[model samples]
Target chain A: MKFQQSQEMRNLIAAIFVGIFSYFIIKALTDFDIVPGVSYIYNLRGPLIAPNMITVILFDWRGYDTLGEAFILITAVLTTGILFGRGVLGGDVSEKDSTPIRPSTIVQKVFAAPLVFIIVAFGVVITLGGHITPGGGFQGGSVIATAFFLSVVVYGFKKNVFNLSHNSLETLEGVGALIYLCLGLVGLGLSGYYLYNVGADLYPYLGVGDTATRLFSYPDSTNAGIIPYLNIGIALKVLSGFCTIITVLWGAEKK
Target chain B: MNGSEVQFWSFVTAALLMIIGIYAIIFMDNIIKKIIGVMLIGDGVNLVLITEGFKPGGIVPIISEKLYNQSPGIFQEFADQASYSLPFALVLTNIVIGASTLAVLLGITIKLYQHYNSLSVHEIFKEEKI
Candidate 1:
């Protein structure tokens, strides 16, 4: 009886805490207006391009972290391939049953085309406006990868998204990673730090002040040049890397 | 004490989440549940790091009116202010990493499900060990 009473008391305390938290969260959102745009909305005259700041931070200021993220995806893909690749599929009746018996959904087929087109268009927008706006390589790449995922789920893995087979995706992923490394090496070769402003010396092409004429007194060299290239490389690498995992999982027979 | 209290609550919530995740990993029988626990732990750590970046009574890191005295041609002081862009960026990158890790785990789980009809984590090891 004592144990049951204590358990009930604990549950009551937990419920009270949760209620308090929910109340505060709702109050903050409605009364305090503690929204995501607090940085801008509460205080007028925030940066005109807040999202651009978001993008630059993702790709340039914190490029090393982005590299680490890419490595995580790569590691996951590699691990998946290793433990559950062809070796596991061989000589197993269980594997044969892994393939889905259900046909493709009508709704999926209807939405897949538009979804792929829109995502690809979004990727283009990100790639083009990355320097000036919030979207960048990682964001664009993920968007592109989502298209592949949509196609696979909607039209069956082997039908529409055939270009990115498991073997092909693996190869693309390796190439994507290599491209990122190459861009970083370019920075180190010229600027002493990996992924450093190889773009600074080369910033003028993107309409950033020419490094030759104006240093801009900014502590770091202008990164207008290679930042775009880095963005593209990263976009390709991440896009392929994400797609690779999704493709493999979709294609795999269960056993 | 207002902002400080907020920070304290945030930290406590993060810690509690982490503790729950640790317990889940240790006790959960299913591999998928274990993966979810790991993700919970990652989210808790990320929340702590994000909360650590917030400065009490500090204005947004953006070059806005809050930092400036609004006097004409007096932008010198605000130029040196620290920015919150780094933490925001870290959160985005961490999110991507977390999602990718989850995808891989799901893939593995699918394969595991194929090999064994059940999702119980320990059973696979037990059957394979002998």
Candidate 2:
């Protein structure tokens, strides 16, 4: 058909155009410095501010952006639930996903339990060590959620190691979001800023007492005050949010 | 390869990925392949941002107390030698956003399949009523 031919021609043209444009753009990007950027400034101040540069930018400088990022995951999970007949405008709530999950082999069954524990432990270390090391809450939480995935894949969702109820996962997500909001509110109450790192090392300048600082601060040499807390909060939210999504997609039982 | 060379190759690979993804999205009839195209585009852009963060002979942008205990005055040196952190942060945020969007897209695809009983784009379009 003529229409089909035109569609194919258009697609080819678009692909060629995109390829050429990207090549030029990359050439320009590499050849030109494009003025200066804040990366160097972040590097200079990052050591004194926080040991991990990305953590400082995400938690301290771009806290609002991080909040939006977490909210996106939550929104996606809710949308998935809606698609599965858990919300308004749904006729019947009896549909199940046809993903064809096969029965697990004996070897997989034997190894899955300990593997879940080890994965969860590694995720915790990543979440708690965000201030001084790489792999923050988002990465850590995703890692932890994989353990849930593994368990479900190997043992089926009914008897999986992390067969938490829908209500519990939703509650955990809310708790995580609240932790993040309350921490920002704490900063707002003390200083005029929302996510200001008002822990001991810097709070003295704000004329706050040492006891309050110690209370706000975690035991990190980077003076990374609320970053670790934020990490834990984001990790919890991301973990629960991702798990909720997978559970819904894998087909939840009718309530 | 040097940093610039590495960046060039990375950009080439990213562009190829994006091109293939766009091709899939436009020309492929299967809905699942289209979804994968969306993912491929996101991955290409993420790669570009990551390549932009690369520095020639750069060090990791981390400062630890253990490293400090050995030499308390390595901050300046570390800053000079470290790769760009801003783009790294941006890439991290983008990855999460991309994953969330992918989840939403797949959900929509599932709903569509349930309603239409077919994964072929042309078949669904032909079957659509006014």
Candidate 3:
């Protein structure tokens, strides 16, 4: 008993140590700033004021990287699908996740229902406003996916997720990916650059920017005309990719 | 701390977390632990990428009319956007992708557990070979 207690104490100590260390480290870093050495690198201007410099680099300067990233998502989804195969919703396992923790109170369940819906709505709003703000499709989609994941945890398979079925998820994923690819193709046709910017004005249809300036006014001259489309394509593909993973994992077959 | 300090500490925290994550993967026998470690590493890498673009005390690259009030007579064009926004956007996408991959890996772990009835990586490998 003493040994067991000591081991538990050690684990608690370790956890506390790690937590404290992380806090102090972050605090220290945030508190410190260097004198003006790299301001020149940081001072370059782009078409929009972005939350971070990396966004400018990815979409405006090195857009091809973004394209590669989109492809990576495509590759991962394809690989997972191919390896796991379709028709995964049913398998021969006779058991279900039947361990009963304290059953949810009716009041709790009712409260959760509206809470989940509100959270999902928030995710949708974030994704829609991605171009204008810090949140984008991936973050929004993941937030949405989290709601689904959380619902599964709270309500379990037999109660909460019965409506979504496996097939709907697959379809959503496929359509999402196809839309991403189509957006890229549209960019190519409009600006001679794959995944070009067809701004908000081109609503519901893709159109090249009327007056193209070199991206960031840099002489490198890549992605000069295409950036917005890339962002949209990325958002769509990421959302789809995450949702697809959730479906594949949760929707598998069980007897 | 100032901007540079903030950047430095964030980088250090990220690095430490990454190292711990790698160590967990190397030492922990549990598949779940390994997956968690992988996630830590992913997060750390994302932090590094994001930090790489920071110019201490630099502002975000969005343009708004309010900027004229904040820094009167500053170039109107420069106030709106910064050079760093593009890379930041890309990194944001990457962070999302990394998170999804973690979710997928966790799903795989669940499947493995369902098949083997155990979480031990060594045991799973042995069973697979047999």
Candidate 4:
């Protein structure tokens, strides 16, 4: 009885707080032009270096923050592994209670192989074309992970076509992160600043000769130094990271 | 509605979603429900950030020949007409971070469920000493 009463009180307090917060939020959002008036200066500069503005910001201007974000994902995945990993506390605590269900024959026959191939190809296009288009490493990585997810769902985890073991995924993730770090160090070695793109001469051949009338029309000898490499690194890291997380979670429950 | 008004409406909708999420967190007894509430809140914040980047009459912040032809100095006039891209970038980062965090949380929740054999927060608290 006492607990119930306290719970009600807590609920009331929470409601009051939310109400106050909502009022203030609405007032501030409606009244004040809180939107920053800054023009797309970084974005305008993006084409000079890389084709994508978001990529430039993420991998060049704010490379350190992205590194941190990647690590945060790595740490979170590790924590999840530690918490629920097999053999952590003798064996897997959660076990499969029922037999796995097979999908309809027609559904499986129609859409399994072709869909996976298409999705993977699309993901690759997005990742590689990060410099030229709207999609980037993160988006492409997620799409690839989605393809993996579909395959795992259609064919049982044990019988999936993309038969990448957890160890391989882990290695891929680590290598991706290492490559990113090495690229940053390369920038530091060549230029004084870490992750610096200026004068690194990443795509020397492409930037030579015409130097201006490229298909993308990069500005004034500014090459997309190390940005595409960084995008590839991020794509690998995110793809493997997500794949590992899902695989671990799904396989946690063994028969 | 005007551009600002549209933004205001979007902001209002985002806030309402957040409020609904808060209500779920406070009132729902299911641990999974709480996690869902947290997701809703994150979506609300992402919506607000994306909305903030919207310009009254701006196109996608892409540099093309059309923009350059209009003004050779693409940095000055072309940028003024394009919507801000910074918020979109920030939101993309936030979304990935949120997904990872949510995955971790869900994993923990699964462990808790395995131990307690129940999804109710109250039951788990009552059963466990801690």
Question: What's chain A's TM-score in each predicted model?
Answer: 0.64, 0.86, 0.57, 0.80
Tell me the TM-score of model 2. Answer: 0.89
Fnat of every candidate, listed in order: 0.28, 0.61, 0.21, 0.52
The full ranking of all candidates by lDDT, starting with the best, is 2, 4, 1, 3
At residue A198, candidate 2 shows an lDDT of 65
- The digit string of per-residue lDDT tens for model 4 on B3-64 reads 88888899888888787788788778899999999999899899889898888887777666
Off by over 4 Å in 4: A5-7, A35-39, A86-106, A198-222, B69-74, B127-130
Tens-digit lDDT string for candidate 1 (A81-192): 6655543546413233243535777887787788788888899678756655567787888888888877777776667643566677878888878877887786676556
Q: TM-score, chain B only, every model? A: 0.79, 0.87, 0.78, 0.90
| Deviation in Å, model 4, residue A35 alpha carbon | 4.6
lDDT of 2 by residue, B21-75 (tens): 7767876889899989888988988987887888878878886566556555356
Q: List ranges where model 3 is wrong by over 4 Å.
A: A1-45, A48-64, A77-103, A150-163, A199-237, A251-255, B68-83, B127-130
Taken over the whole model, the C-alpha lDDT of each candidate is 0.62, 0.79, 0.57, 0.74
Worst 10 residues of 3 chain A by lDDT: A215-224
Task: Encode model 3's per-residue lDDT on A102-145: one tens digit a residue.
Answer: 57777767777677788788887676555445565566666776
DockQ comparison, 2 vs 3, better candidate: 2
> In order, how many clashes per candidate?
4, 0, 46, 0
Q: Where does candidate 4 clash, by residue pair?
A: none
Model 1: residues with Cα > 4 Å off, grouped in runs: A1-51, A86-101, A105-107, A201-223, B1-6, B55-83, B125-130
lDDT of 1 by residue, B1-130 (tens): 6876776777767766665666567557788888988899889878765766555565445454443445333434443333344566677678877887787778778867877778886566764532
Q: Rank the candidates by TM-score, best first.
A: 2, 4, 1, 3
Candidate 2, residues A26-100, lDDT tens digits: the string is 565546442228888777766766788888888877778898888888888888877777775746474655544
Q: Say which prediction, candidate 1 or candidate 3, comes out ahead on lDDT.
A: 1
Model 4 CA lDDT for position A217: 34
Worst lDDT run of 10 residues, candidate 2 chain A, spans: A27-36
State candidate 1's DockQ.
Answer: 0.19
Highest TM-score, which number?
Answer: 2
